[model samples]
Target: MHQKRPHVLGIDDGPFRKQQDGEVPIVGVVMEGATLVEGVALTSFPVDGAEATAFLADWVRGLRWMASLHAIVLGGITIAGLGVVDLRRLAGELDRPVLAVTRRETDGSDLAAALHAAGLSERMAVVERTPPAWRLERGLYVRAAGVEAAEAERLLRATLHKARLPEPLRVAHLIGAALVNGQSRGRV
Candidate 1:
């Protein structure tokens, strides 16, 4: 059987304020191969809150084109403070595989310590439940749900263009940053 090109939706959250309680903007980009199909935005609980999974699932479910998406890609497992993504819940709700990508290998110990310091120790369990990150290639690591490691790697390879990150993810990051800062900065 011939494999179809996956229509992937990449999600990312904008930067947030450090000393205040507020919502953070989250951006989702839908893409097929190198073509961008749609962009959607939502808000999540302030940094260190535990509502990312439910908020994301609800946002996705409300999209009219949700059924056209084949897989989901996230910029990271945490967004807007320490709101952790429940990979299993997201995948189960969408009935699609989900992948979280990071630019560097994460130090679990450091993350746990930070969460503890932030009074978000409860988030550690959710973080621990995320599948361990696997190196998709040099400078790229990923954790996935509902997809095999090899297949995830293949999808990443196929979707990556000039950067190690997937195009949809890069676009989402750029859009998210621009919305927050008026101008985008950092490596996309």
Candidate 2:
């Protein structure tokens, strides 16, 4: 079969919470490939003042944009100190295979249950939990599939190491975070 640009979407979901409402979720979508497609930041409904169910509906609505995506690598915070963002709701929005990464400290079964509870259990892959220390320089993990294993590995490694952040998604982080921070500060 022929292939398109061979891209993967890496997501880093975050939330900002107040004393009363708890956590507010913000999603960052990063597209990694030759052209480095732009990343988008979206608020999943309740984050923007809508009801939770309605927000989930709106969040899932963005999947059409990723119809061409080959795979998705998903990760969210789980540290008790950091306060976790439930990613299963967002995962339900995706229609492709998903690799969910967590902290090495997290139990695999717990992670699976989390996704399953969110109704995304079928499309999930549990990756070895990587720590925040390692994530400082690595924004996303790139993978190449549907090709020679060696070739795929080579391409992924090259892209991941090419820079501290891949072109497409890094800008997404900047823009998305800026928007979130701006909104928080009442600047935007």
The best candidate by lDDT is 1
The residue-by-residue lDDT of candidate 1 on 84-132, one tens digit each, is 8889789898888889999889867877887898888988888888888
Which digits, one per residue and each the tens of the lDDT, describe model 2 over residues 4-88? 4456565543435433243444554656564566456565323223233234335545655565665544443332112233343
lDDT of each: 0.79, 0.41
Which candidate has the highest TM-score of all? 1
TM of each candidate vs. truth: 0.90, 0.45
Q: Which residue pairs does candidate 1 place in steric collision? A: 47-80, 47-81, 48-81, 48-82
Query: Candidate 2: worst 10 consecutive residues by lDDT?
Result: 126-135
Pairs clashing within candidate 2: 45-55
